[model samples]
Target: MNIEELASILRNNYTNADKGNKVSAIHAFGVQYANEIKENNYLATEIIKKSGLNESYSTELSKGIKLYDYMKNMSTDVENDTEHELLSKLPWCEIAAIAMYKNDKNYKYTPTEVKNLPLVVLAKKIKKAESPSIGTELRECSNDMTTDYHRKTRNLFIRENDLYYLSENGIKYVEENFSYMISDDIDMPLNQILYGPPGTGKTYFLGKIKNQIMEYNKKVFAKKQSVKENIMDLSWSEIIALGMYKANKTNSYKPNELYKLEYIKEYIDDKKENGGATPECSLRSDLMRNSIKCDALSESGKTGNDYFEYEISKKVYKLSQNGIDMVENALSKYINPSDKKEINEDDFCKFITFHQSYSYEDFIIGIRPDTDYDGGLKFKEKRGIFKIICDDALNNPDYKYLITIDEINRGNISKIFGELITLIEANKRWGNEEQQKLTLPTGGTLCVPNNLYIVGTMNTADKSLALLDVALRRRFEFVPKYPVYDIDGIYYVDFLKKLNETILLKKKKADYLIGHAYFMDKKKQPKLQDILNKKVIPLLMEYFNGDKGCVAEILKAADANIVFKDTFHLEVI
Candidate 1:
């Protein structure tokens, strides 16, 4: 077939295939038309352009052609070759890298080995096998693959003068056999403290985690029926039976009274706009499907009991005692924090900053006076923010609750956590075999739930981890959040890197190093002089304890002294 016919066929296949299978269809097209593409240098480009696919398809086509040529030249039975089997599964860039490696080294890799090898491993192998002065074109190709793949895989290869070379770990990785496939599992610590110098995007990282949770919830919501479909069919009694939809103060209500049809419709529409379950019947349905514990309900009272009982005469519904408990539990778990009255995203992924004044009562529980009572002031037991979150987390076993503590090291851990310090440990959390609970002064018991994750940020510039309470250190995993210098579109990256290097050399610690956040504005776009004058200089002053000479020395290392020409007057501390 001519180029136009092939392109049309490719376009049809691409359009018909699902999102995930589209790349494979493109590869298949290239494989089938490999000879034609090889003969005509511009055939792949022409076909890709005519196919009306994304620009990314051009790279995929090149990769597929290279892979096909390599397989056909290496194998007598090219159509049935094992290497051909991997063409669909592996990334286009990976296939191209393998082809390049085979061409340079004249060494054939088994399908098993090829399947097991990570992109970084192959890139490392290619770099090692090739000559030191490999031609500019080949080196550039290798560099492109390394740049594309290395960032996705791991930081193994270092680039120098547009050439890729393996680091110490990369060398070791290449020497190892491809016995096992690299795992795709990302390690998410249940209790992690991201400790770093200030402005290193610690809270920004927490925001990212919150966004991911929101996206996950959106996906879960997308698969279900539309809001109108779920709400439009439900009666006023059924909506009230869910217990989330309540009559406003303006609307009169008697005992066991069903809301008027107009009032119910208004409430449902308001819920759809603001929050709640958009009729709450959909939420009940979801709970019944995912969160309801049938066995637990059966054990609690009667077997084979539905969550709600309906009275035909009154046209009203009553929730079972066990069902009330189950619905309360499910509501906390399934409903987004934003859905609840007077609650927002902050209520879901709670954020709190710790300071010297922050106390155990403020964190867990405390006694406060109740002035609202009739006569004199009364002392009452009140749960703190942490305790409130813990209660919700305990109730909602299906959902994950996050409490992000900013400036964690500023507070006294022993004073703040009190006896509940041991409860935060992974093994000691509720539902674990070694789970432990502490009795409060108010006679209530408290345990940190398993579903609750505590992520804290500590500025090392204020206090180092070694100096933190041993009990706190032992219970939490510390993940270092250092300044990243290689951010795209950020000017003065080289200056920041040099400044950090000098700080490490002089201070003998990374704590005093400047963070990348300093160079960015509120919009996260890079800013230059204003940040240097206002934020960066002031921070340097604090680090050096107002010693202008030391601050000047560090800035000079980065050739940034020109910005602070008037500020540094060589005043020794």
Candidate 2:
């Protein structure tokens, strides 16, 4: 019903109920209100505002309403009568924390564990559970309600009395991570297209995915014997030194604490007085070899033994139990390192750009001219990049592979993909019953493999997303990458914001706005005048189709240098 009616029911219920039942009555009201709103935050907020509840009680009730809605609509099977009853009995904060972890693909808490554990103990268990990714450790703080700068900066949860709750920033973080887009399906597709204006970092994002794939491949091929050798080469003193470093760095005595590879190598170099003389790659390889072994043991449940106990998260690793104990014993004596570097390895990713001339023959398979016997030209069957990657992925099922197509919308999709478009659907991949293959003109059959993922970057500035081919649209998940104004160290943030606003107001489309990359420099910060003169002004001129006055007006509104006389001029010089 309406907010007023819902608010009146809630107010009356709490007022009439006994003190012991009042809290339960409030929670029940929250559930009822959430059902009525169907997870609409505005309606819930309105109802809470109209209820005349105290600030603290209203905030708690609001969280309960959101938690109820999230749990009810989540992918997990929580619709059964028994599960529903159990959920209704649990505290809202506890359920929120559990629901958060459950939604993450990394965490694997069982249904039995969820039902049996108390909130405080469950929080501890979740902390103890090893997260596969680095820089994702749950941070704990004292109950004194002090400001935690790190947690505040990272938008991570705050722990008080062994229980976790979302901070103000953490709430936004949770919503972004947990909420599904309207077009999103229950199962997120392996094929995704990141579409946005040029320079919005779509390619940059794909680069990150490529690195992750390479890391995955490294882990898949890691040798246990090599790892054992690396660890065995280190003396007991050195091993204890590394372990103590990890413990002090992470503030964790856990068996599988993660540390960065470069940090460990630097510590070793400093300890040896090498004056940074060691080859960087050799040090990195040695560190990775050992860490990969630790990861293997951790995954196989062989950690916490006499030989070793540790694991790698990305390029970071935790030391063994023996190391942690020794470090704990000498906690007062060890010194922490100051410098840290992120790890990067050899490339295994395939990159291609799609254009008007790109075709199915270029993407799948085609016959190419080759020298035959007697020096006569003859056609030979040649496999395309897509087919090659698919074959490789099929052969190497244990490792992940990625194919990135830049400027995907620039090509004629139907002409490029042809019948193979149907083969890319999630169900039509190599292993499924619905898997289908197409016979190429060259006489071989092809099917996209499940282990191979396709990521494409589409520039909206080149073409509107609405005009994309429907067949291609159905197969790939489209993620919108928009311009970011709040990036640190970027010049002219306010000007970019205003310029985009003006463009949107004039053109009625966001696709034509300038992207943040124009103002960014990888090696050094770009001069604003140079950007305005060489990049921004020309782009604006192109966007306005040489209508200098219109461009001048837009620039004026954004507080940029503009001259409007008989001829419009950008006063960058």
Candidate 3:
């Protein structure tokens, strides 16, 4: 293909390649040399280079190296061998067996013996064999055999007991269509709303995203821990021990040492995005770190230590021992708060229900009176869930923060989100030039972090998409979740399909159609009679509004019957 054609193909299917390949391909296209590599050899060279192979070998032909010289010499060496002629007709698998035994790599096996080798063992050896030419050819054949044409028409089964062998075609399919794969390779949508009728697994899909984020978080933690251990001169654990030991001797800590520790804390914060630590702990840590930094800079005559001034009841105080003690006391409530009980994943995730009364203060930040240590309430600025998540995101840049709002349309969007409606935009988030920050009703400035992901579920049947707030709707990309009628082992798939057709015809809308989830039992198996009697009939009655004639006609079309009882409830007949 020409460079222009190739570039177009890549642009359309960039997500198909692995991450490194995708990046390299993009970089190659960006450079001036891309247009010169229109031939297959040069194109293959680019692909090979992107795949982490050496690029120099691609120019061997142009460098006066004869490709057929080595082959001709090898052909002459093996020309008199009778086995070569006999082995030519055999399949690659059998030929591979004969070659392995002939090479005699500390072990020997007859062709029959090698052919009968366990599939797992054979597959591993075939892929890892020292002879790349034989191994690569056999692997290609194995993968090509799994194609639908080969599997159905040729009825070819390279049986490996009950195990399904991975095919080259299968791998290619996953790599090409990776965005739709059931894998973590796909990027999570920044602002996605899964909308559908009730029981269509909208909320359940949110849980899936949460679980994916949780897994991603764990990986980020592990990677950060590894990098921290490998790169840091003094680790956090050792710093904590030294700090505590010094504190025990006297209230006064060394200035220079504290500055170094504070610098290290910044590194940790950058690595973690401040995720696992509580909001109050992060605040206290930041304040203390800043105080130390200020004192250090002041002594060096670079800057003044004026950053820590605070006033309470008209009395000004520096970021001193009193403030530190206050933070420690407040943090004590959350530290080992569960009396050494292990915290679970659920503790970190927040689920907020947005309603008409839900305000910006409630969602982001607020001011509430704090109870004094002795008595009475003190005016205190409180951090809300969003702020806490933002702090966490700031500390842990690699990890994602997910906020799932159920029934998002039930709330007054303009009122609840307020100024945040713009900040939530991908381009307006923190680190972007268009980023926004607002001083909360409490105190601190708040901005939505880039790592924070918002997943909301909306029941379109309850409120049509047209009724949603236009500003709120524009911020989120909606993904429709339709009912699955072709669930395996479900006998009512045809019945539900017919019923949904009737519903759309009668109700004049798709949202009111019955969802497949209603008929699914606890084990996720279909329960036909139970669904028909308890759920389907009752729902249909409400949809038709007790129009018995219309309901009866709908049921009759689906080869089912419903009867109106004395209690005015419809029952399966």
Reference-based lDDT, residue 46, model 3: 51
TM-score of each: 0.52, 0.48, 0.50
In the range 1-573, model 1's lDDT, one tens digit per residue, is: 677887898898788755545776677667667787666655667788988888778877776666676543333233454444444455433343333232222222222222223342333343433322122222232323333533233333344432333444333332331111222122367788998899888877877666544433332233221221233233443344343323221232332253343334444544443223545454333323222243323334433434444344543344655545554564333222233222245545787899999999999988998876567888889999899999988986655678888889999889999999899999999999999999998889999998788888899999988899998888888888899976554557777888889999999998888998877654555455566667887888898898877787887777764433455543211
Tens digits of per-residue lDDT for model 3, 245-348 = 32441334333344334323443433333122322233334333434344423344422322233343433224345334533553333122223222245544
Order the candidates by TM-score, highest first: 1, 3, 2
In candidate 3, clashing pairs total: 8
What lDDT score is found at residue 483 in candidate 3? 83
The TM-score, computed over Cα atoms with residue i paired to residue i, of candidate 2 is 0.48
What's model 2's overall lDDT? 0.59
Residue 349 C-alpha lDDT in model 3: 70
- What candidate 2 gets wrong by more than 4 Å, as runs, is 1-188, 223-347, 563-573
lDDT of each: 0.59, 0.59, 0.52
RMSD of 3: 21.7
Residue 398 lDDT (model 2): 67
Candidate 1 residue pairs in backbone clash? none
Off by over 4 Å in 3: 1-186, 227-344, 377-379, 487-491, 522-526, 546-549
**Model 1, CA-based lDDT:** 0.59
